[model samples]
Target chain A: MKQENRQRLAGAAAGLVNGLFGGGGGTVLLPVLTRELEGRHAFAVCVAAMLPMCAVSAAAGMWNAPPDLWQAAPCLAGGLLGGILGGLTFGRVPVGLLRKAAGAFMVYGGVRYLL
Target chain B: MKEAILTFLCALVAGTLSAWGVGGGTLLLLALTLLLDVEQRQAQTLNLLFFLPAAGAALFFHRRNGELDTAAVRRTAIPGALAALVGAGAAMLLDVDLLRRPFGLFLLYAGGTLLFSRGKGFSNQRGEEAPPTKKTQ
Candidate 1:
């Protein structure tokens, strides 16, 4: 398959997952982008690509139920702050260990949900 | 009041992780539902919104650095949008309890994969997850 086709497929897969799950599309999109482009650009491109996709999905996800802005306020506050920190720290942080830790916790979290 | 603070703290941590590309949105969703007593679907929706500002902030730096590829975004975003509609509808229709199990299994799969995969940098351009034999086109 063409790389473009593969990328589009990745995009669709990512969109579906994020919309259904309410997040996680970037994970689906990243690996494909990494292969298609250089690592730095791939991450940036994936981020850019996800914005619009998430916008559409978020809008849909919120249709049946809207969050109270009061509840959303603090979370958004933290999220915005974290985003700035992470963005600045991007290549600077040693994410390999962090990713592992998060993955381990996610595994634990997943099991907890399961049982 | 306490819950608000807790939610902010959790979102802060999750946001950083996600901004670093570690899939922290999943963590925030779980934290909200299990730890803070938020509804699952609501948590999910919140997670989606949570990503926007975080990603937007990151995009600014990336764009300044000339790291973005507009052509690629064009290729991917359209199909992604259409598929998102299908996924979003299904998510809303399902009860949170029923949704929990499938979502759980997915989490397990993704987390396990992340845990087991070879360690690599966040940017990925540093040389990993690429084919040893294949060349970039």
Candidate 2:
């Protein structure tokens, strides 16, 4: 298949996932690209890719009632920090361990919310 | 040939994760590093770029529904943007493994805060009760 076709297919797939999941596709995409494409291209692709997914999820969350600005602001601030720090911290960190740690955090958060 | 198929599959899965509210960036980064052998920095950068449209769409939808606080978004935009730059700069300065430990700690802190902190809507404001949110008649 052509690259454009592949990308379009990928985008559509991403849109659907975003529609269903809310905000967690990059977790899945980056690895695939990294494994397949490898190197800087994979990294660039991952960043470029999440733009749409995050935009969609945020829009959906705010679709009916906008969240309190004060509340959202801090989170957004964190996100910005996450983006920059995440980018910079990359390569130097032991990502596998980081992944396990992050996963543990998520599990904890999820359990708390569920309970 | 294999790469093309894998990329498509990855995109599809990532999209689903994002839709569910898990924030695809982190997971994608994990996959890149563990499964694909992609470097961390490159993964992070790409993840951010991917988030653009997803975040934008969410913001637009919220705006249309009157959920977006334009003033608030505007207020934080400059500061947040600057912070992002600072974060990026900081990333460049530190050893990523070292940074990861602290970052992980921060996440734990944030999770703890969310789990333990009472709703700040009223308690933090002295003895005053929070104003009841009136439904727009």
**Could you say which candidate leads in lDDT?**
1
**Which one wins on TM-score?**
1
Model 1, residue A100: C-alpha shift (Å): 0.5
Across residues B18-91, which tens digit of lDDT does each residue of candidate 1 receive?
76777777788778877888877778778888878878887887788777778788788888888888888888
Give the 10-residue window scoring lowest on summed lDDT in candidate 1 chain A. Answer: A31-40
| TM-score for chain B in model 1 | 0.83
List the candidates' TM-scores in order.
0.90, 0.43
- For all candidates in order, state the fraction of native interface contacts they contain: 0.68, 0.04
Which predicted model would earn the best DockQ? 1
- Off by more than 4 A, model 2: A1-115, B1-13, B16-20, B107-137
User: Per-residue lDDT for B118 in model 2?
Assistant: 32
Residue B128, model 2, lDDT: 26
lDDT per residue as tens, model 2, A64-114: 224444333333443443444434333333333333444565545334323
DockQ of 2: 0.04
What is each predicted model's overall lDDT from 0 to 1?
0.77, 0.39
